[model samples]
Target: MTAPNLSANLLVELFVEELPPKALKKLGDAFATTLANSLKNAGLAPSTAAVTAYASPRRLAAHVTDVAAVAADKPVVQKLMPVAVGLDATGNATPALLKKLAALGADAAAVASLRRENDGKAEVLFYDSLAKGATLAEGLQKAIEAALAALPIPKVMTYQLADGWSSVNFVRPAHALLALHGNEVVPVSVLGLNSGRQTHGHRFEAAVDPVIIANADSYPETLLRNGSVIASFAERKAEIARQLAAAAAQAGADLKPIEDDALLDEVTALVERPNVLIGQFEEEFLAVPQECLILTMKANQKYFPLLDTAGTLTNKFLVVSNIRPEDASAVIGGNERVVRPRLADAKFFFDQDRKKSLESRLPGLAKVVYHNKLGTQGERVQRVAAIARAIADELGGGELTKQAEQAALLAKADLLTDMVGEFPELQGIMGRYYAQHDGLPAEVADAIEDHYKPRFAGDSLPRSRVGVVVALADKLETLAGMFGIGQIPTGDKDPFALRRHALGVIRMLAENDLALPLDRLLNGVFAQFTGVDGFQANPAALSAFIYERLAGNLREQGYSAQEVDAVVSQQPQRLGDIPKRLAAVRAFSALPEAAALAAANKRVGNILKKIEGTVEARVDPALFVEAAETALHAALVEVVPQADAAFDTGDYTQSLTALAALRAPVDAFFDGVMVNADDPALRANRQGLLAKLHAAMNKVADISRLQ
Candidate 1:
């Protein structure tokens, strides 16, 4: 009878000083994954073992299920020397063979059972053996060491151990290590701490001094009931979220928490026993921009600001405290007291910033260095204004031109504002507020704020035409200036975020479907850099960079690689037309004749490329000598005009569909007529006929790529 496997659930915890809040979650995840993976690699844990990670402000823990007491023995095959090298004329084992066998812990007697196989050219001998399984104690120690070594610690600190003579580098000072297997303590050591069942919990609110974890399955329950801590990171985060929603609901039905995942994550890492408390500030502080107030609350204090149904910030906010008390008035009052000074400082910055208009800050930008080689922010503003003006003209010269230029000039003026200086993310937002306070045109103010829209993936684009023009110009100027100075992005090293700027430009043009040609816009930007020293003009390289980004963007939008390659390979000047071109390619690919036509188009392109000179796409009917050629020429005469008309009218699908009539003629011509004819006139005429066919087939996209 076969024996059943002996297995158990294992738990490990590392008690330490408070970990860095930003890195706590990642550290917890890395700790659990590395430990589990190492155990699995060592065969001490099943491949399907369940791993649960626990993290609190003062601890990191992991619980793995179905770990074996010892791994099962595995069979191994060892390859030896070839038969010719291992044996002599008498077919007896040589000294080399004896030595190889000895190294494998086998003697000459084992050679009789050796297996031989022809490995390509010659026969080689191999030995088979069973490797002994590793014990759980040894495997667990190795897994713990490896997991500690693999932690993604942002910074390491060296601290002396209790021994006072030795020091270790770690993310934080280590206090205790707890390792348990099933219901028994597993003797293991890490970071100068021995394994134990005791661990400390909440600094002030624990039900017991030392939480006794009875078993691997009881770790979280013990910590919560006795230690007054929620040990699981995910569970604690969800609990905080639930409490926040409930608190917001209690405040008012129309009120809701300002949703920010990053803020929630940061707050989650800051507490063990989360207690939501309500706090309020003076209503006069709302006179400051809500963005300023909210940034102060969220960034400085880690508070969740409440908002009304109209999305307006209220005077009250919720504070997530680590301790729960019968009467929470003191906690709420303490938080309110701590936040009053922060709000007052924000108000002071706002009042000081509003003392001067954005126009007044224009000259100050000349002193701000944007880049050491690219001159000052003032110069950049001028360049952006020039490009915006040109784009405005191309988009339809009118009020847009004036608004775009004005917005571009004032866009960087916010860099000199007190609020923006205090919070760099508030640059554009503060500029809009200041512009409106200065009584500038509403379009100009909105454009200034909207120019930096679509700042990230899935973000909204500019809502106004003036904003679009300025946004395009702003991104273009960055691309042109950076490329001019030879600061091109290489591999993953884009210090200037040039790839993001290129994507922003592409999204603006393609998503907005503006009439501006990409090449023309790039040239306009390059023109603004005239007379700048050390600036090289390489429009083609910059154009290639933008097109590469466009190709990736198209593929991410779910277009097939072939479709994107076919369209982008042509370097279409109007990016706005790409979606239509892709649609046309998709529609054409679905047609019954698309496959044959694409293959034939590829064949035609290869033939035309081999010719010594340009093949004019002008066919002469009189020069066609074969019936196949004459038929193809007649078909072209009838279909080319229809396709051209459809193409001119922007009916790309219809244009490609019209060329489907040439498939039969194309196949017949290739089968019966030789493209490289014996006579020069016949060859030239055939080449012209093929060139005409090629041009018609590829008006929307390079259909040959479909092959």
Candidate 2:
């Protein structure tokens, strides 16, 4: 393939044993980045760069293009080894330099040739610099190796060097190594495999002697036509989607794309010539819960299911296979065998779970650990129930709270059963089955099942208030319990998924329109936490940590990052009060002087922040020399009461609006009077007046936090 109109080029391929779908996808993207960044750091770069990544079960390839042939070369600077002891400031080498040269196995003649500077200090500097327009191949190779070295392959192995060197360790046995600069394979070696122009195609199709990959364009098509596998992930995905629809049409059904991209990526590896064939399951299996059927099809069978007009699932499945089966009977039978076991497992679990009441499962949860330090799952249920009841009563759900109390007590009970334990993902799901079996109200059973959603972004939300309450309570306990032990998600490591939990809380409140203040709720969780070493929780520390979660949560909700910053700037963030505060600030954010107001507040803050000597706030009204100061004082007198009322009533917009009334008077005072005037008494009064204005502005938000 000719060099595809690119300035520079990049190609990277990992030939590994079958890789997990999730890991392969992650590594594919990661490999692209490593290659691009590697080029940048080596004084090498691309005019335009694109990383095309693809992965099958056994191999991953990242191709970067439009890169410079050679990275801009860097100069290697060499400085004479620290003036070789005492040289008496002469131009001759000292005894120390003689000893070092002898020790380094360097010739004395070479050291003598390294002369001193013209200035005559016995030290000289030399630089080995490479100018521009050099080939970037060597630099690119080094970058690739660096990136590959640090890769996070959770499972790795070492392959013995067939070339008689040490074993090469990697995620899988890297069958072959390939790196290309446009059409040329950059010579490098890894895992005892030489880098070259040849790339092997599909094992089933082109398993003979290696095929030559002449260039970039030729590589993919050649692989597709003869190699029989499309190594470009985008191509593989499109083909899968196309075939799925075609097979659905042939089977007289429609396939809806499941909301499981990870599953899609995983299935991609299990196939080369992705051919979707629609198959059928017994219609009676529909009696299983929709979730059980869908999960079984998607998770176990790697099949996509079809639905009827009323939205009930039809007895159809979409089977994506690696190789097309000519007769299709064998493929159909194999898929049925795979799906039948899951369906049977779901059916058996459904039947077995119903033999006992949700309440019966409660006692078993005591044996399950919520945390080694935080009692049992049974204990957690009690805590969640208490919080849920309080929240329900707050929301005027007095009747519902009592029912939710019953549900919360048994919400996690199903966690102890064999089915739920085996399928930990079906926590609330199993609870619903067990609840319904005991003839509890449908609302309660539904709530038990629906409590943990929308489990992910764009996922479904809880329909029942009972579910919402339990969901909130459960998340609250997690945040609290984790925080109590000083375990919060930081960086990319959230061993407990605390960030997800926080986001879930934010979604529950916003999507459900619960509009509950998170302060009181987060505070409640903190209250239940006993710190490490069995120490009672420090209410102060817990409050600070939850504030971080709240700020992060707000930032993700399309709230301006600065708005979250401003709201969090308040020392004691009132969780129950933040939503209203944020709303008020958002409403005022676009007003003619909104940014000015925040700027003014921040300016006032810069003054108040540095109170070297205590300045009393008793502004001497009698000595108000500037007319603007008196005008500002008059506005505060008029606005304080109304602003306070608005703040208390959660009418943040109104509060900010009322505060803005002081802007004109504030501008007038600063325009005429020096805050630090020569007259000590007048300066004191001016500072006090400014402090008063700042105090009034803070009711809505620290305003200084706004942009």
Candidate 3:
């Protein structure tokens, strides 16, 4: 294939009202990517074309290099119909063929040029033609429409255009549309706006009323110089980050901006020209928890709270202003004034919440519904406390059970607190603080806070044994309750985050190596909801769901699917032992005898599965008539005891390694021995020997999966 030669850089922009700040970056990315993909598919741009996306608060734009003025003509080969159908026995054109030809813009005169070939079953007529290339003007219009339709807009606004009657829907009200190819204007229209070289600059600081982009390559430079707008989202965000660091350095040696990508992106969308200004509030607000002050500043004011070397929140914060005035004092002072009320509200909530003990707030929880089917938070707390106590008993009953019960009881009490009600993200955090203030045990307070640990992937696990117990109980209770009510997760829709809860339980069990059996733990949680109405608990199904999550997580952690399948197929009761089994599988896989033993094990399993009744693992040596069977029996007698001892001691790697000695005898036996012997006694004995070998081989994992 030859490449198209005529190409030029293309620019397209949609100037509109302020876009949704949180979705600005996504919209901009989708706009550029979808448009570029469409143009490439349409042959109007090379697949290798470089695409650059730009987004500010009021505009979304894209610049593509090496876009064709017109797409290359594409050759099309379309199958018509069978020759017998298209032409009669007399070989004259039929009405069907004529109609088909007419639909393709061809007439009878073109029939002589049609190609005929056998299409497997019969001779078929094929039409060969060239599809016309799309002009740049037409292609740009389609690209723009597709890009707009593909944007991840949170919502659409429908507004009347200047025509007064006609209306268009977009993420925001579109005011201008610009399209340029090289130095020429490409005529296209969208959202009731005609494409031109003109677009508005910054609302207050532009040097010109309309920035006239000369060419596609000059869009960013023109906007920066004449429009006083940094057009690129990435460049603007980087600039803000740089300025924030510089400002922090100027303020103190150890100061740094609170690192948050979402906040930075939102602030970037809010400004075209970023001016970093340092602002300060009264240090008295620091008396409140740093998290409250930090959340208020970042969430309400979009300010980056500065932190010291010890990661302590300072009274100073940085503001990203849209304008760069000679004196930044007004901007700084205004930001400081605007933040005072928000900080005071946080302080008030904190103070009011501390007035009452978290224990006293427990009764109020009955007013808050946990789930429609799951009863009130007060009832949910009781269930969690019960589960925690059971788990603590399994781990090591005593002070641990007491602390876990206390923590689980107070865990949901914070939901009624003023601070947590105002900031739900601080649910467990506020609980810890209030528990400490109420003179609760330190471990109890810590457990209350850490119950929600490892909230997401790669998050930390609970540090205390009581915390671990409580966390496991809490997550298991959620799973049991949700699944019991048939609110199970399906596909991508998990309203209750059941997948996350399952993974949390898996992490706690595996990472902590807790001796608790998974089935028993699940059954314990399920047993707690016995008398609750509308509760249809399925312990087996919930266990399956957890195992599924564990399998996926193991795959993500770099374990091969075969190894995971081998270990997980057994449905081991202890999730903590799965890692050891997987490790044993890996070690076994490297041994020279692993392949033959795995294949033999698979064969034995298949043979045993077909048996009508129970096949015991008792081998009487006198019944073994074949030499290979006798050798296999001897090998088992020598190896099974050692492997069993290793397995019993939790040395799975050694257990699996010990079975390597059976490869030679097992292979010879499979090759020589016929399990379906003429005598019933001989057949039964051989089957029994194979069962014993299978049992020994799979003590750690189902080695058949290795096959």
Candidate that scores best on lDDT: 3
Ranking by TM-score: 3, 1, 2
TM-scores for all predictions: 0.97, 0.81, 0.98
Q: Would you list the rank order by lDDT, best first?
A: 3, 1, 2
User: Model 3, stretches more than 4 Å misplaced?
Assistant: 1-5, 88-92
lDDT of 2 at 45: 66
Q: How far is candidate 3 from the true structure (C-alpha RMSD, Å)?
A: 2.1
What is residue 238's positional error in candidate 1, in angstroms?
0.8
| Candidate 1 residue 386 C-alpha distance from true site, Å | 0.2
Best by TM-score: 3
Tell how far residue 349 is off in model 3, in angstroms.
Answer: 1.5
**What total of clashing residue pairs does each candidate reach?**
0, 11, 0
lDDT of each: 0.91, 0.72, 0.92
